[model samples]
Target: MKFGDMELYILSDGTLTEDGGGIFEYYPKNIWASYEVDGMTPYRTDEHNNILAAANCLLIRHPEGNVLVETGVHDKTLNYVKYHNIVKNPSLMESMKSAGFKPSDIDIVINSHLNPDHVGWNTVIEDGRLKPTFENAKYVIQKKEFRKAMDPGFELKNDYFSAEEDVLPLEGSGTLELVEGEKEIFPGISVIPTPGHTSGHQSVMIRAERTMLYAADMAALVMHQEKPRCKMAFDALGREECWRTKKKLLYDRAAENSWYTYFYHETSFSVGIIHKITNTRGEMEGRVEKVEIL
Candidate 1:
């Protein structure tokens, strides 16, 4: 969908389905279990635990060039067996084509964080050579994020990897821009530092008269936004800060009344607005409504 002159699209490199328990290991078992109802729970779960589904990436286009918010799964190396039924075979090229964009046409690629799911399509295997997918675009990532990923002792293998293959190659080719906190990468696009998920994790905020926040992992789902105290099991800095950041974003946006928020794992392929309504007991409830695809 198009937002003003900005064209937004979903590029599905692929989907990853995880167990619900694995997602919220940081939260108490009782607290997590309270959310389950009927036979089906709102959170994705395997036989033993609950999980969150990593949806596709958001592709944004402006008159100057194209900006891809996140890159989805790169290839079949990562497990796809569990999600085979729910996630259709991913063809990012086809998805881009459907949205009226080509790989070569993308001019800017932004890595919200260095997570495997977020940077999966950063490099594509072509004739056995791992190369940048967006040939002409400069890859923008946080300086601290790149540094943390580059650290050899980083324990999480799946989360951080060799900069040689994933990140440094782009820098070597002079196609990387490592920006500091709250830096403007484009005229209307800015990166806001939102740590806790990762040391350098950042959220993308697009500004106009009305603003849109493409909050990457800050609030993975509606439930996370609703219950800010809830935490993701995979969070690096524990749950408290994550919850604090989530609450701040949710409350701040609701107070503003004009900000459109989008989550990476949101079910719909559109922008959502949060509304507050008073309950029968005079308690405020937040409702998010999808406003537009862009």
Candidate 2:
């Protein structure tokens, strides 16, 4: 949707299927079992009856230049079972083109963290060499997250290859900017520290007269924002900090009347707002409304 002079668009590289257990591993089985599913349909499982999971990405644009929040898994690297049916699709680039942009036209690439799903398109593998996919843009990453990913002894699993490929090369080429908390990267766009999921994880906040907080993995799904106490199994800092941040930000956005609140893994609509309402018991509750992706 249009916000001031900036034009925001949601572009899908594609979709990835995950297991509910993997996504929410920290919650007790009984608690997860009792959790209610609302509005959306749960992923159908095999005969075993396990719940499935999926996620998408968001791309935003302003008159100053194009900013891509996350890059979907590129075509050749989708073979890993972690992501079902992952294939190189020009959908992201195509969508950008349809929106009047070429890959080279993107001026900035903001990665929430070094996660594989988020940095997949950081580079395009060609002839055994890794290169920046968006050649002209400056890649923005948190300083601490870069150091963690660069540790030689760190396990390469959980999509860490994204760090070896997409992120490091940019740093080497002098195209990466490492920022600390609340640093402005582009006009009206700032990077805010929201660690917990990863030691250096971050979220993007866009400001005009109103604000748009891109919660990133800070609150992956609507459920996390709605029920901030619910922690994800994949969280690195333990669930306590993650939940605390979620609750605080959910309330902060409402109090400030942020124009939009965006989540990285929300399926229905990638960009939206969370409203706080009081229930019959006079308890505060969060309700999400999907914003039109312009």
Candidate 3:
């Protein structure tokens, strides 16, 4: 994945499982069953069946230093994300080691959002307190998202985020850098606002010889764009906004078949270009045909 001055690597943080009901409305029951987390659950229970997803963190290497995107889940936050499975023997440290770097070597961490699964590795529980996991990294977050997450909400819809375990630790470390809207993190790396999954959720864009969009929760799963519409069960926060964002990304990058997009929660194949496939009705359709790089 070498393009221009940037070399991008997709490292595995492990996997997760969420209820099938997390998808949006309008689909048929049998069709929805396919959304279940496992092959054995193709006929899975809608209310109980879980959808297995992966925690894929991206690592961008440059002449200056390394930039990590998303940091698997932490053990302390397991109660919030019970379905999450850190299958990796020792979690992110092992993944980072395989990539030729250590947690302490990361100079920056760009959080796609503060969901427990996404920011779990941001801190570690040490002696009854949370501490920064990446001792040398400064985290980048959207001001808008941070405010909303900080504001009150029922656990109701907000238990997925833990400010104490994830945010406050960084705050105490004085390494949290809040930015407005979308901005470029460095020469070739940029974070673009693609709200909906979370009011402040943003995706990452890397521009080198080719363009790639890390469609965070905005399009969490690759199958999300496989269907005619982009909908999710947990889209309660920004329903309307989520639809629009998904549409634009699908039409522009996925449909147009330009950018090499990455789905934050996909397991089968994460990186690929979407193409239009013909259906039995002789109509054109969108599907994510998997392909690998590096």
Candidate 4:
């Protein structure tokens, strides 16, 4: 988990399940089910073809402070996940503590997007009011994403962004800092705009002696990294744009063995080096190698 002098570790806020058909929107159930993600609970699909998924959050132990990227789904979402027979784990706070930190120990939180599973820990219902979980940390997100999450039409994204439960409380906390495209969130870390997954979806980029872009749900699982052009149903905003983002991240930036990549929801291998593979015809593409921290 140590990339040079920088430190990194993954914490589980627990796991959840999604309609396998829902996450990989464009792919048929047969094609997707054919792909397998090791280290993940053997994906159990229900009559609806839903599969259990993990909410693996990344933590960066930087000298500036500790940064947590993404969180698990709220307990409120358990019924849906359990209906598929997938089990949830401890709270994000307990997971952090078990990993030797506390909720208040987090210095900054980078939400890849406004999705419920990604931003659930942003606020916790306490005393009948939404309360900030990390009192001292600043919450960062793309400015464009914040705007998109607030738009009326985005109500369709309510499952991803709960206005009253998630957004307003964090926005009102004065700890929220909306980042412009590719802006640094302190030092050692930056964000790249990946708009197709959501109107303002962004991926976290860490740079120090080494570099790694937390691809987030962009590659919801390792299979996407193995296949960049793969499509997802949840990409309601920009399908083509999302595909371009995948190419730019996996084939371009992550090409030439320049940087490592992290898949937020990848159950088995969340972080790895994406190697650009060249076939006999000299055509090029990207796929992950060196699966680590399973």
Q: Report backbone clashes per prediction.
A: 5, 2, 7, 2
RMSD of every prediction: 3.6, 3.0, 3.3, 2.6
Model-by-model lDDT, in order?
A: 0.68, 0.69, 0.72, 0.74
Report clash pairs, candidate 1. Answer: 19-50, 19-51, 20-50, 20-51, 21-50
* Candidate 4 vs. true structure, TM-score: 0.89
TM-score of each: 0.84, 0.86, 0.86, 0.89
Leading candidate by TM-score: 4
How far residue 119's Cα lies from its native spot in candidate 3, in Å, is 0.4
**Predicted candidate 4 versus true structure: per-residue lDDT over 98-135, tens digit per residue:** 88998888889888888677777788889988877888
Q: Give the per-residue lDDT digits (tens) of candidate 1, residues 68-130.
A: 888765343434334422353556677887877887888888888887667766777789977
Clash pairs for candidate 2:
26-233, 75-88
User: Weakest 10 consecutive residues, lDDT, candidate 3?
Assistant: 37-46
Winner of 1 and 2 under lDDT: 2
What C-alpha lDDT, on a 0 to 100 scale, does residue 162 get in candidate 3? 72
Evaluate residue 293 in candidate 3 and report its C-alpha lDDT on the 0 to 100 scale.
76
**Residue 249, model 3, lDDT:** 67
